[model samples]
Target: EPEVTQTPSHQVTQMGQEVILRCVPISNHLYFYWYRQILGQKVEFLVSFYNNEISEKSEIFDDQFSVERPDGSNFTLKIRSTKLEDSAMYFCASSLTPGGEGEQYFGPGTRLTVT
Candidate 1:
């Protein structure tokens, strides 16, 4: 089946450095999002992107964070400065629409380990 794919399944970064994680959405899906999952914790929504702009973002998406779909298919999340607290598995997801009966599809996720 068609599915979203993320690159470099795992990343180890030093604190205070920038990191960019990449994802490719499922073909034909529209709304895209970024979510974070801390070890043994719930998946938390970080930001939602649609129509080339950010539709919604959580408090965790502060000044140091940003997302972009530079190309029609690939989506990327960038952290200006990595922090220890930012270590987590980051997932990329997409749905046919912003909201409705359509289900969301998620990528395998990029495990970011900041130290």
Candidate 2:
């Protein structure tokens, strides 16, 4: 099976700033998603994209968060502004199907540190 890959394994930024986290999902997968896990907390869904458009998003994914498939092989998550509370590990995921049961394959993750 193919897997997701993410770059910059770790990212550190100042509060109120912006950051872009990158990922490359399995080439044949049709669905992509972004999820975050604050230190010591459960993983939380941020958004999902399909067919070059957003399929669903969580409340935590406010106007500040945006996702796009810039090209055939790259998917990205942009946080318009950073907040201290946003410090967490951001995981990029992909699925052969919708997020059903345990079907999503995740990347190693990029740890975001907002100061």
Candidate 3:
């Protein structure tokens, strides 16, 4: 079965640098989302995109963050400027909205560490 794949598995960056995390969502899926967990916190939704525009976004998706479908299969998240609080496990997810239950399938995640 096809699955979402994330790169680097782990990343380390300086507080003021930029970082681009990569993901390949399930081949046949449509809805894509990014969520983060700050070590022991709940999974917080960052943004959701569909039909080439953002469908919904949370307050955490500030000016420093962006998402894109760079190609047919690759989805990426870029943090323009990192901060120490930005460190977290960035998860890329996708799901089929079969009746709107929204059971998303998540990638292993890219653990971002800012120093």
TM-score of 1: 0.96
What local lDDT does model 3 show for residue 52? Answer: 72
- For model 1, how big is the CA root-mean-square deviation? 0.9
Runs in model 3 deviating more than 4 A are 98-100
| lDDT of candidate 3 over 1-115, digit per residue (tens) | 7889999799999999999999999988888899999998999999988877788889999999999998888889999999999999999998876215777889999999999
Per-residue lDDT, model 1, residue 18, is: 99
Q: What is candidate 2's TM-score against the reference?
A: 0.96
The collision pairs in model 1 are none
* C-alpha lDDT values of all predictions: 0.94, 0.95, 0.92
Candidate 3 residue pairs in clash (backbone atoms < 3 Å): none
Model 1 misplaced stretches (Cα beyond 4 Å) = none
lDDT ranking, best first: 2, 1, 3
Clashes in model 2: which pairs? none
Q: Where does the lowest 10-residue lDDT sum fall in candidate 2?
A: 95-104
Residues 29-114, model 2: lDDT tens digits:
89999999999999999999999999999999999999999999999999999999999999999988897855898999999999
- After best superposition, candidate 1 residue 85: deviation in angstroms? 0.4
Q: After superposition, how far is residue 83 of candidate 2 from its true place, in Å?
A: 0.5
